[model samples]
Target: MKVIKLDAIDSTNDFLKALASQDELDNFTVVTAENQTKGKGQMGSKWQSESGKNLIMSALVKDFLYNNEQVFNLSIVVSLAVIETLKSFDIPNLCIKWPNDIMSYNKKIGGILIENTLKSDGRIVSVVGLGLNVNQTNFTELPHASSLAVITGNTFDKDILPALIIEKIQEKIGLWETNSTDFWKQYFNTLFKKGIPMPFKNGAGQNFMGIIQGVSSIGKIQILLEDDSVSEFDIKEVQMLY
Candidate 1:
């Protein structure tokens, strides 16, 4: 991993993406910031963090060679990596909220934002941006957000956590080339709210209760509604209601 440590920046993902546009970056090339002025999240949301107190990093995933259909698997890999890293720190009740939110005890502790570069035929080269709440213990406005320090009652070395997560991510990238069956199985097993009934809101803003089944290979969520009918949804099609 070629690591670039920045004191402050607008966004690590944007920085790495700009570098990738200029030239081919090595696989696992990383850019991390102590402070991000405008940190981005999925669906154009903002990721909030206290300066120098969390993990704000982006990694280059070159030559992944996955088609558009398999893009979500990349998300699965990154999310699982964060989960695995936190578990080693003994964070309790770790779970992955669908479409890449990492949660513990029903509160979000981490999230992933992935940007992709597609070839002429539409295969991908990914930029995986990760934000994990590490030592920060204050989240006054973010009612559902928590951190490793908050959950465990112990302050952690923020710098060390990112390196550990990157190492785990590298292991998952090795699986991308072959035998992804095990990774997929682990993903489903760690999925949050799996087999539980919960309220959800669809794209139309309609609300209903549904049981979490499993996600499809391409990343569509499968849910069994109250009427015993099955429905599959893309990320934008539905959202889990807390």
Candidate 2:
């Protein structure tokens, strides 16, 4: 997997797709930009990344192992990859929020966004994009936002960190694909909350108090609600809110 660094790009995902469309992108090829002018977030929200302060990169992946709704799990892989990478820095007290957000001290340090581009034959061509706040101090006033430097008090950020993170990503992806239980256990350990019952909302706006039972192979999360009943949801079907 060759990682391509750019001085600036509008969006790594867009760049990768343009290349993929021209048959230029290979699986595991990475495109990272110093700044993304039009970076996107969940639900078309603008991803606010100050220039040269965070990781704005996209990875090309051809995951044909998914069926129907399960295809979105690449974001999960990318999220877990980011979490593992941060841990390599010995950054303490970091946690993985439900779905795809990583946090430190209850504030989000970074996130993953995965987009799928298809071939004419219906094969899945995914561009997993990560916007992890790395070397930065202040950001536009957002409560759930932070950076690696801000969290770990490190003076340096992206220069030496991206390579380390890429290595961790490869390791995590391999482990997650082979041993699902081990992946779940390790992911659960870094969860913001696991055993304790907490209030959560789903996509339908219904609320429930439940324990996050971690991720399932189906990519749905198991929620053991206060009623002693268990329910499962895919991605945005459940949103954990404190």
Candidate 3:
């Protein structure tokens, strides 16, 4: 539970990763920054946030994963943790956009990006980066982006939110290790747009309509197609058009 707070950094994830490589770090060691000059998102997208107005952090996870197949479990654990934390603040309509985007009322509020390193001795370490809009209110350029303050109309303490989220992540990880079946059910239940007909665009920019059934064990989104067939697609292969 060692937390390091920074005024500015290029990326909390990069800082933690470099630190882990140099020293033996405890699990759940956290690094948070007020400003990230190069914050990143899924598929190389830049994460934009107003300095000191959001929650930007990364946590080190060690000895939690044994195999590559279990990597997606981290995504599930972190997603639910954020959702649950926001719920405590009375953030309404919280749901997880597939893979791991935090949404409220069909608007993007936060996001997660996990990076894993497999050791030569068969150990795995993960750096979980999270960016949540806490007090920020201006997203004029980004139409889909919104903040907790904007959604709830109440300002939040960014410092308190990250600690709760980290605690929830640890708690959910324990539950997942004990009974994965139940964990999967919880994740599916919070899945955004589940069982609803929606439009999707593939990598080739082809639009199609499908219903999100569930996610595969390997983290691919499973969609029920128009032909009554279920197909699993990788994150890069499909994009939900809302």
- Please give the ranking of all candidate structures by lDDT, highest first, separated by commas: 3, 1, 2
Model 3's alpha-carbon lDDT is: 0.93
- Evaluate all candidate structures by whole-model CA lDDT and list the values in order: 0.89, 0.76, 0.93
What value of lDDT does candidate 1 attain over all alpha carbons? 0.89
Residue 237 in candidate 3, Cα distance off native in Å: 0.4
Best lDDT goes to which candidate? 3
lDDT tens per residue, model 3, 32-125: 9999999999999999999999999999988778998999999988998898888888899999999899999989999999999998899999
Quote each prediction's TM-score: 0.96, 0.86, 0.98
Candidate 1 runs further than 4 Å off: 120-123
Measured by TM-score, the strongest candidate is 3
Model 2, span 1-242: residue lDDT tens: 68889988888989988888887666688889998999987767788888887878888877543554656456555666777777777767788776677888788887777888656776878887888888877866877788878877885657666667667666766776676566666666877887878888889898878997766766678888777888888765777787
List the pairs of residues colliding in candidate 1. Answer: none
